[model samples]
Target: MSKFMVLVKQLYKQKVSAKSFILTTLLYLVVLAGIMYWSEIRDLIFSGDADTIAVVNETNFDVSEVLQNTDDYEYEYVTAGEVAEKLKDGDYYAAFTLTDADGKLAAKIESYDPLPLNDQQSFQGMLSQAGQIYAMSQLDLSPEQQQLLLSSEPIITLNSINEAAADGKSADEKMAGVWISYAIGIIIYIFVATYLSIITTDVASEKGSRALEMLLVSVKPEIHFRSKIVGVFLVALTQFIILFGGLLLLLRFSDGGNKWSIVTNLLDSMSIGYFLYVMGFLFLTIFMYLIIGALFGSLVSKVEEAGQVMMPAMMLTLVGFYVMLTGMGNPDTMLIKVFSYIPFTSGMVMPMRLGATDISAIEPIISFGLLLGTVLALYFLSLSFYKRSVLTYSSGGIIEKMKTVFKVTT
Candidate 1:
């Protein structure tokens, strides 16, 4: 046990101190932080540069009150003839002419640059409201009635019928949970795939260099294998902490008034219990994949065969991710319910169901139990295979190597 601990510590330090590991951790932190704060960064860079639009009113209708004005755009009123010149000279991002067309309003927008969809929709809404007012006036309705007609109805509030009603979580809370689950699923897929590859490559490299032979002389294969798993997990955990910790700090220090604080909002919506459960499931899932990775890594004789050996685990992870993504749209489906109980997919699907719907306590308990049992079974099975085949060298394809391992175990 002492020897295993020493080996694990050495391997962990070796991995964490590597130049590639340091560079990749920093790069991922930067990339994740950039993605989370892209809107804020864009706003800072383009703060004062709002898109300007030139409006040419050919009709006598006063529809200026219906137009939207905000930081995203500025409207300049001009004559019909000035529209073409302004647009041609690129003085404005776009020019639009509003005229009378068969007793209704029509607008033609011309631009040096393509208008954004949101801007186009806003203009369309303005024109539609103007037409409605004109039509109401033609009906001989009083100003009060016209005003009443133009006013919108009260918004209908929707409440969840699930057990979360007792918890008093709002719609925003549930939506935030859904987003968190999707993000968790995606992160798990990416991290598992990346770390699994790293584990397989590391093991294969050690084997290729005949370092495993010398290491095995002093330590049993089981201790060496388990120590490597723990060491790789520590390396991955350190990277995870660095990336997420930097993001948390960035969110903490960022401008509170910014509208792009999605990460903060998601974190706020998660309760302590939910957060702990997510972390628990996430760790279990990672450890399971790491064990499977180590098992396959032990089978490959050359570093180049690492990818081929890890393909099965990669495929399983991809399937789980795909199911989680597609299942989110319909959580109550029978197929998704079945998938939520599956050990290989439970880590991704169960969290999603818990977030998007109301699940009974028993459901998560059963799913978690199944997942725990599966991990344990895979761990023992992988250890058995590793003990039987770690030292064996075979210059064959993945299938042939797998056959050899099974033959030896048998």
Candidate 2:
């Protein structure tokens, strides 16, 4: 046990050697900076409203009053002629033409570019409301009757059953669930990219430098291979924990505010107990994915071949990632449920379901245990294959050989 610990430490140090450590640290810093810069960049690019509109013959049926009533856009009344024509030339975004229809009104809006559907809907609705009010005032009904005809309930209203109700989770919190899914997808990519590359280069270097033959003289292949796997897994997990923990701390104190508190309450909607449970579940799944990825990584004979072998793992990760994102609102299909329990895809898929659904507390705990068991089993299974494959370099029959190792172990 002590020797294994020593081996693990040595492997961690070797994998995270000074040069590599500095490279990864720099990469992480760049990623964080890019994330921070994105929001600022969006604000800068989309800053303020350049929007201006022109209204013609607005007094008797003033378009400015109606448009301004909606608070949709800023408008200025303009007179018609060649001067008004040139004014409508290029400076204004849109022009509204209003005409009297006896006791009624008719109108049309023109814009250089096509107005967005949502903007069109809003502007048309405001015009409709104003027209309705004008027609109502012409009615012989009393003011009370006019109020009765015009008054209506808002489109949406919520009545809370619980005494404690929050404004609900912000867009950021709702998006955090999706973004967190994306983050797990990213974590899978990082692990697969970093350590698979490590294993490939390690294998290629070993074969190229004749290190395997020399190292085999003192240590068994299985011990060396398992030690490498253990070491690489530790390094990957450690880096992930640092990044995740740091992100949590950043978010906890973030003044940026919640992005989607409307969909659900950020704090009140989820029980603290389940949130922590799911987070723990997420960490375990990441560790499992790293281990399985490292196992497949050892079989590559050359550094270039590493990516080809990793395709299966990548597909598995992609399936989980997209399913979580696109299917968040969809009911659980058989495939999602199965993927949630399966080892390879569980890391990304199940946690997303947990976040979006109000599942029983026991389900996440049971799922965590199942994932933990699978990871432990996979470690031994992968180690057996690692033992057989790490020292052999022929290209054609690697998959067949892996099967043999599994067959023997089973």
Candidate 3:
């Protein structure tokens, strides 16, 4: 326990400066502000009523009679000869003209201002109802029958095999999925950026300050290298654990007994099995990324060279995110199923598809096992590189480095 505490303390001491902590905190604060701003705007946009629109009745058609019966929008009727001119003069936000020809009704709405989407839809529905009512009256139907014909009947049958459900999720549910994807994406992004950048800076700073010479005397290169990798990995994992726990707590209590906050809906809708699967994938992927990133960091002599060395890991990240994007629509396809089994991209792809569709639990478990295996193999391989490259710096492909690490000489 003491040894573990010592290692953790050493790791935390490296980046515990006031400036770094403050900067990180400020960045999160700014992000929170942005999220709040977006919510305010969304509420404002969706909460408004459709603007009051006027109708002109010139063909002895009671446009008011037809419009008033509909619940979609409020309309005022004016007895005017030049309806188009009246609409253009801005007495109303919009004006719909009513005309009957050959026992059929036709309607058109002219707007002086930009029409809201809901308003446009309501206007179109009003026109349809007007046509139906006029047509029914010509057939000598009573008012009750006309009203019945105008109203839509509720259907009990709902059929959608996840594909149709792709678009049918309510705004809150859709927003939740989108927010979750983005939240996960951001977690991956920050983990990679922080740990990888930390390692690169550590290598370059040690090399620059000539500290490697003094530190190399007591500790074997492999021990020092493993300690650094393990230390940073542990730090990242700890921060992730802390953040995840905090987020979970926040999610649990976010509703404030309102029963309708975004955080509550997210937790309520998520299945236990699905939650476990996502957590497993996240943990496995972070383990793999930390090891791979540490290896990339160790191979470079200076921080400037770290980016070039880290290309493979970066490429893996890109592929993982790209596969996630592609898997959005056809989660059940054979190609998607196969991709979910692969180690590198599966972390991002599989969870996203599962969030969007129904994926069997067995497949995720198998994929998780593969990812763990890959992490182990990569960690050992990275340890070899760290041993060879920490003291000795050279420019070569990763394949050539592999030969040197294994002591293969021709």
Candidate 4:
């Protein structure tokens, strides 16, 4: 036990102190911070270039009162000659003429430079509102009558068949849950893929250099393997903590009006029980990947072969990631429900389903049992493969090596 602890500590230190690890951690923090403040960054970069629009009203409809300026646009009432002169001089970003056509109001928008879609949409909206107000005034309608005519009808309430379906969650909360589930799935996929690659590379490198032989003289193969798994797992856990902790701090200090506040609120609104269940499945999935990665790493006789050995694990992780992303859109799909029970995919699918729908407790309990059983079975099987293949020098591909391991074990 003491020897295993020492090995675990040694591996953990080696990994955490590496330049790649340090750089990757810093990059993740920087990127996450950038994403969190992207809206502010965008405003800082583009807000100064507010477009100026000239509105020429040919109809006697004093629409200038309705054409308000925003931070991104400045609207000015101008003459038709001014519009033509500005277009020729390139003095305004855009210009539009409001004229009476076929006994109704019509707008013809022209610009020297192409206007943004939002600016065009805003102008269209202003024209519509002004036309409505003019028509109401011509009809001699009261303010209350005008308001009633302009107002939207009451929204119909949506009721779900599932009586227990996210009973109290608002639309924003439900959408936030989908985003949170997606974010969590992406995080798990990244962490699992990254750490598994690290484990495979480390094990293969040591084996290629014959370091494993020398180390095995003092330590059992199973202990060494298990320690390496635990050590890499710890490194992943540490990175997750630091990255999420920094994000939390940023969220804490951020203005409530920021878009990232939505993400923070969604996280806070998540049930602890749901988080625990997802995490339990996630941890088991990580363990299964680590063990399988170590086993593949053990079979490789050269560092150059590490990527080939790790390809299948990478593919599996990618499949799970994409499937979970698809499932987020429709969590109640039969395909998602079926995949949620699969140990390889459950890590991604189950959490999304749980967050987006009302799942029975027994479903997740069964998934946990299956995932746990799969991990334990794979644990012993991987140890057997590792014990048999670790010391063998092979110049063969993964299939050939796997066959050799099985033959020797049998």
- Candidate 2 regions exceeding 4 Å error are 1-49, 55-74, 79-89, 96-109, 113-210, 245-268, 331-334, 397-410
- Clashing residue pairs, candidate 1? none
Q: Which ten residues in a row have the lowest lDDT in candidate 4?
A: 164-173
lDDT of 2 by residue, 1-410 (tens): 55556667877887777587668866785676556456666567766654677777643644454567222366767765433454447677677766667877666787877889987887688778877766776676797987888786556544446544433443344555544555555666566556655655565566545676786677776677666666766777777777766555544444354432332354454457646755666666656656665666566565566666666666776777666656455525666676777766666666665655434556666677788898788878877777766666556444764665555546
lDDT of 1 by residue, 1-410 (tens): 49999998888988899998999888888887787688788889989888788888887777677665666778888887777777878888887788887777788888877778987887677678877876675688998998888896777676656744444455667777778899889878878988898888888888888999999999999998899889999988998898778867776666663534666667777777777777777888888999988888889888888898899889998888988888667666777788888887788888887777666668878988898999999999989889877878886877798788777678
Say which prediction, candidate 1 or candidate 3, comes out ahead on TM-score.
Answer: 1
Residue-pair clashes per candidate, as listed? 0, 15, 0, 0
What is the C-alpha lDDT profile of model 3 across 1-410, one tens digit per residue?
Answer: 44444544576667544377447745664554444455455557755554557776546555567677332356777655655665678656787767777878877678877788987887787788777766777888777877777685765544556662333434344445545654675677567667766766676567546686677676666666666667777666766665566455544444353423656668666557667877777777777776676666665566677667677777777777766666554545676677778887777767765665555556677888898888888888767666666665555776665556455322
Ranking by lDDT: 4, 1, 3, 2
lDDT against the true structure, per candidate, is: 0.81, 0.63, 0.65, 0.84
Model 3 per-residue lDDT at 249: 53
Best of the candidates, lDDT: 4
Return model 4's CA RMSD, one decimal. Answer: 3.5
TM-scores for candidates 1 onward, in order: 0.85, 0.68, 0.68, 0.85
Give the Å shift of residue 194 in candidate 3: 3.9
Tens digit of per-residue lDDT, candidate 4, span 1-410: 49999999999999999999999999999898887777777788988777788888888777767777777778888888778777768778888788876557788889876778887788788788887777666777887988888895877566677875545455555666677778878987998899889999999999999999999999999998899899999998889889989988777665664646666577787788888987897788888899988999999998899999999989988888888888767777888888888888888888887777766778888988999999999999888778888988777778999887777767
